[model samples]
Target: MLFASRPTCIKRLLVIEDDPLTAFDNEHTLKHSGYDVVATVDSGEAAVAVIASEQIDALVLDLGLAGHMSGREVARIARDRGIAVLLVTGQCPVDAEEMAVACLGKPHSAAALVSALKAVETMTCKNKTPRKVSGLTTFWRPEAA
Candidate 1:
């Protein structure tokens, strides 16, 4: 008798956005896209706290967080911890392409977010190396809706 292989576990995502509405929308979209959104927080401090305590697979960070620590800093920390990070920002920083696995512009679609996450996961799984903040980056721009 042949036994079927077990399915891979869903990825756990953390959404860090200052805007309540945007955070809610992002959480909803990620959930419907099959990702397990472990936490949604409004500040960089909160994000750091959650990251330290959870088994998070990825982070959806807003560049302009309302706190002392910018999202860029948080992403760097997360990457150091071997977690993947994707930036969702209105004004993409000059170094964003170098800091994250992928950078998506603000007002992006759910499909775009999902696609970026898949690409990050694929690259991470293939490399089997510790996540480096200075690694190659993938910038995805969703078509106008």
Candidate 2:
């Protein structure tokens, strides 16, 4: 089924998760969900580097990555650079009103992931939200800023 997105610009996404299985799942799901996942990295440092050097339009970021650099840090960098971010985690949610467009809790469905991303896309473009899904929380962010 078709999703809500700009017809011409397939969102260029990046996936950042430390868990091998989750990372693989995210990439596969996103690819099938009509998003162009440009890269998948497992650390904050690598995520930072990819966002800096590539044309990444969004990030599917998992907090609690095993590293000195935190997922929050990468989200901030992406946010500052006008890249959309959707933070995912099972632990305590971070204070991310400015740094991310949405927060998706763990143990979610592929449909939830797609719906959450579509919600973020619509919210960013139209300032309107879609139907809320379980485990998905959204926040307002300035257009690409």
Candidate 3:
């Protein structure tokens, strides 16, 4: 089975999470999946700074960061900057309309993360078309963004 790979230029990602163990695990998984993680910040403030400085392709954000700024803030900034976001959090009840990023529930599988990342990449593509999976929706385009 030859699976399609995401765009090569957009391989960098940022991770914002308060838990070191989960962050490490996620980093390892993303790296194994061929993503170049730019940084791992424990707070949304730090994440904002890193995002401002680096050319991040995507963000794996945790809503409950240990700072005044939350992942929602980071996601908002990313959306404004046209950077994609993947929100990972427990059931804390976020306003879907407030978030322009993909939301993945806690304790999600690696396959789900990969799928979300791929969808985000596809959405960021130049075409901006949405792809429908077996029973899920994904924004995927073959054009460059």
Instruction: Judging by TM-score against the true structure, name the best candidate.
Output: 2
What are the candidates' C-alpha RMSDs?
8.9, 2.9, 4.0
Highest lDDT among the candidates is held by which one? Answer: 2
Clashes of 2: 0
* Predicted candidate 2 versus true structure: per-residue lDDT over 9-31, tens digit per residue: 32899999999999898889888
Candidate 1 ranges with C-alpha deviation above 4 Å: 1-10, 127-145
Cand. 2 TM to true fold: 0.88
Residue 109 CA error for candidate 2 (Å)? 0.8
Clashing pairs in 1: none
Pairs that clash in candidate 2: none
Tell me each candidate's TM-score.
0.79, 0.88, 0.79
**Model 1: per-residue Cα lDDT at residue 142:** 37
Off by over 4 Å in 2: 1-10, 92-94, 141-145
